[model samples]
Target: MAPSSPHRGVQHTLSSRGLAKLALRFFSSLRPTDCPLNCLGKARLDFNLLPLEGELHCLELFQWSLLYQGSKLVATQQSSQTGLQFLHCVMELQKKGIKFINREVESFKNIHLKDGTLEIPRLVILDTAMSLFLNLGAFEQCHFNCGNDTTTYLFFMDDLIDYAEQMRHLHNCGIMRHGLESDAEVADFFNQICKEMVLVSSRSYLSYLSKDVNTYFGNKWNGWIAILELKYFSNPWSIISLIAAFILHLLTLIQTLYGVFGYYRPSS
Candidate 1:
């Protein structure tokens, strides 16, 4: 049997040649890093350097898409065997108030050399505040196309835990139920790609959320109930009226006592 890709941790054990192959596969599945909302390459690369989950993986030469210096990818959460639901899910994601892209990736056509040989992609070691980055290797002669073709060149070979672009796409789809040091660091950066849901909007989905999440929602049910119950009646006049009623009762009590005894009058 062949070794399989570990799906839950960072595997930095690939040989130089293996690493090169992994890099090619990573970029092959991507659009471009320069698009308005491509992956948070810097942070995701940091996280991928930490850990990931994949049962198996294999590298194929660029076969689809226009891989350029400026393009964005659709979220892969919807890229099941069914097809590219990125467009269908995009609006749904937005309806949930997330800030991520709300469109489906039609296709990604990879342009290979006429001789069918992929170039050795460029790899560089770069750094940011407290993290390191494995920059995207360039493909001077390579091209990619992202239209509506729903065929991902990913087949199970050895599961590489740190498949950069794939990991980034998963994160965008809110699949990172967990992460690691470098991955955690790019959290804010990752979150920025998509808008978070409004508190209420997110709550709306809590019904279908995991059991643990639903439990938390149940615990905080009082907060939402309060909002729904009093949201309409919350006004200045209501508050003022309540205060006035209390004062009136106190004044009435004082008058009743004074009239009952007329005060201990001295000779006036």
Candidate 2:
């Protein structure tokens, strides 16, 4: 994000990258080139004319920009029915008397617009894991809210998700949009991000949500019923197979009783 603000002894640390000297020279060059009086106002400096070394510094800045940007939205793997499926699920939930509620927290970065909707000023970009973590760490230090509501969301995701199967479960339930190459990648992303984050306290907004979710599954009957439905009758073919099995069992029981009572023997 702003190159970590040129920390004390950073020159020594950045020496390996060979950008230390070039960065200072680039800044020094900016004064003579970037700030200039033109016909209307100060002329926009042409970055193309800079030396190769200066260009490298600019490249580094660009990398920082991506890392400092907003959280990378995980794109849905199936793009075609994304919107339709999301709407269908919402309507189904609504019919079941499920309601969506938003809790209004005192947010430092959330902007209240004229429409009465909260919006966060964010820039989304893709970058390496190391770069993303470093910039996020820097952003946490600078902002009291620690990147606004995103911090809370990330913390929640970290606690709820731990493995590839867990990520897939959320995706199947339409709760998560999996954009990575694999479910493992999504799991790795959260696992790594949690390690990098500086959590303010142990308690978070999603603490109740996590507890409720766990409690729901903790009920023996609830978990068993869910397992049974998903395991035996999740699809049309599975339901058909279950029905066929029930019918076959009934017929076999009738035949066994007929033979035991001699009903099928000698026309009895």
Candidate 3:
């Protein structure tokens, strides 16, 4: 009853006022101006959620948030065929006991397979998307392989995740990790990333992976069987249903044969 906590009331009021002023100032600075990146002529800057900062752009903030939150930008739903294919190829490579080494040394040798093991240098994807891209460009300059594996993977992922729906598709299939708050964030990450990634169309580690995937899909029978396997084994219920169907079919065939033989029994 000592002045009824006046200090606490004052502190709360000050905090609220400060936050309101910050929000107002932050929102007021955003302009819907065209991008300075000449290549993207019609694209406009939309600062709906984030505030404008010098050299600290939206993509940087988004990526920082993603890493800070220890979140993986995953697909909330199934991804497109291209996305699935790309992810599948990576998984296949991983399954093949491939080793990715993140070395400080600059080596041009991109993809090498020896003794049923594949090795490729790793690239770091950090909070700074632009910086990460610039570093990759530098890598292309120094490394003999060019920005083959890292850049190609970036473009491949960028192509796969054009929207939230496709991101969800990959997530649903366990191919993507969910880290961002929403699918839109995941899509936006790639959209902005692709815009920054200038390197495209070159040999990389993924080239062989891409070829293998295309070849696998090119075979109609193999593709069909893979689809069937995915369809039947993707979920336990489907697997149960498939097994039940097979059992029922077998039983029906056996009963039909028995009846036919019994009906044609020789009179003894």
Regions of model 2 farther than 4 Å from truth: 1-125, 128-149, 163-185, 200-203, 252-268
> Please, what are the lDDT tens digits per residue for candidate 2 over residues 2-55?
555556445644452455335534543222112222322211112212223322
- Winner by TM-score between candidate 3 and candidate 2: 3
Tell me the number of clashing residue pairs for each predicted model.
32, 0, 13
Runs of candidate 1 with Cα error greater than 4 angstroms are 1-45, 49-233, 260-268
Name model 3 segments beyond 4 Å from true: 1-127, 138-149, 165-181
Give Cα distance to truth, residue 180, candidate 1, Å. 35
Please, what's the RMSD in Å of model 3?
17.3
Local distance difference test, each candidate: 0.30, 0.41, 0.45
Ranking by TM-score: 3, 2, 1
- Model 3: per-residue lDDT, tens digit, 6-56? 888667655654554354345322211111112221121122222322233
TM-score of 3: 0.44
User: Which candidate should be chosen as best, given lDDT against the real structure?
Assistant: 3
